[model samples]
Target: MKLPVLYTFRRCPYAMRARISMYYSKISYEHREILLKERPKKLYQLSPKGTVPVLNLPDGKVIDESLDIMKWSVSVNDPDSWYVNNIDHQLEIISINDKEFKKWLDRYKYHDRYPEYSVEYYRGKCEKILDNFEKILDSEKFLFSNNISLSDIALLPFVRQFSNVDIIWFRNRFINLSGWMDELIGMDIFQAMMKKFEIWNPFGKGEEVIFNN
Candidate 1:
């Protein structure tokens, strides 16, 4: 069978979430690790936006958005019920993470790039979203319930990025959120999702890497 092709950058949170979802769903695919500086011509051809975590289906359909990739993976096979409950609410939380929280997170992570605000100001903006997550997590193990769901997988990478900006600060506050992060980060699927691969060569003899195999 011709597996789906995934173009990914290791440290990109968007790619990370896509990998996490694929790994969790046990959907095997062709892993094509790419460098942002030297992106393959085919990647741009496949996705005009030229973003990482682009999924090229065997049938020629392409999924460029990371969240869409996650949704697609779960749609194929959701053994753990990742997409089974509270879908509307889950999408709402994911929207906050993607649209609102991501803006503040980018500013916070690269505070030097955005000189209009202090680092603390950016962090403060991020904390408002984190505080909401903490409140939800305080009552349950995962975002929506004790069991992990689509929202948890969708939001984990971004929250992990936010925590890494200043881990000590993150650990000092948000006890529930920190524990939740730790649990997800330590999972076998997460660890597998993070394994590094050689950069893919679109023109040369680059061996195919099977993700979630």
Candidate 2:
């Protein structure tokens, strides 16, 4: 069968979330692990910008954005209702995470790039978002409620990125948020989503790596 092709970088938070959502939805696809520096020619052919987590459907539709890939995956088969309930609010929170929080996270992670501000200042900006999440998690197990939803999966990868920057500081600061992250990260689907794959070689025999097979 000609499954949808997924061009992904293992460590990118955007790609990670896409993979996680696809795994949760149990949608089978061809996984093409790519290096950002040495991206395959096919990726650029499919997407001019050549970003990771680009899904090329067998029907010739291309979805380059990670969030859109996630939505498409769940739309195919959402057994856990990840896309349901308070969709507008969930999408709003995801937008904030992708736009506002990610900016500070990048600055915080690579503080030396922006020497105008100290690392702490950038972290402080990220913490404001974390603090809001902490308050929400304190009230409920997940972002929306006890059950995991689209918002939780959409934002968890970025939160994981934030915690990785300074895990000690993150663990020391947010108890509720830490537990929430731990719960999501410890899930079986997360482990499957993180399974490593050899870099795809378009020039080689074109080996098919089935995602979550």
lDDT of 2 by residue, 1-213 (tens): 888889999999999999898888887788889999999999999999988889999999999999899899889888888888999999999999999999999999999999999999999999998898899887899999999998899899999989988799899998998999999999999998898888888975333545453
State model 1's lDDT.
0.90
Q: Count the backbone clashes (under 3 Å) in each candidate.
A: 0, 0
Clashes of 1: 0
Candidate 2: misplaced stretches above 4 Å? 205-213
Q: Tens digit of lDDT per residue, candidate 1, span 54-128?
A: 998989999999999999999988888989999999999999998999999999999999999899999999999
**Model 1 regions lying over 4 Å from their true place:** 205-213
Report the alpha-carbon TM-score of model 2 versus the true structure. 0.96
lDDT of 1 at 187: 96
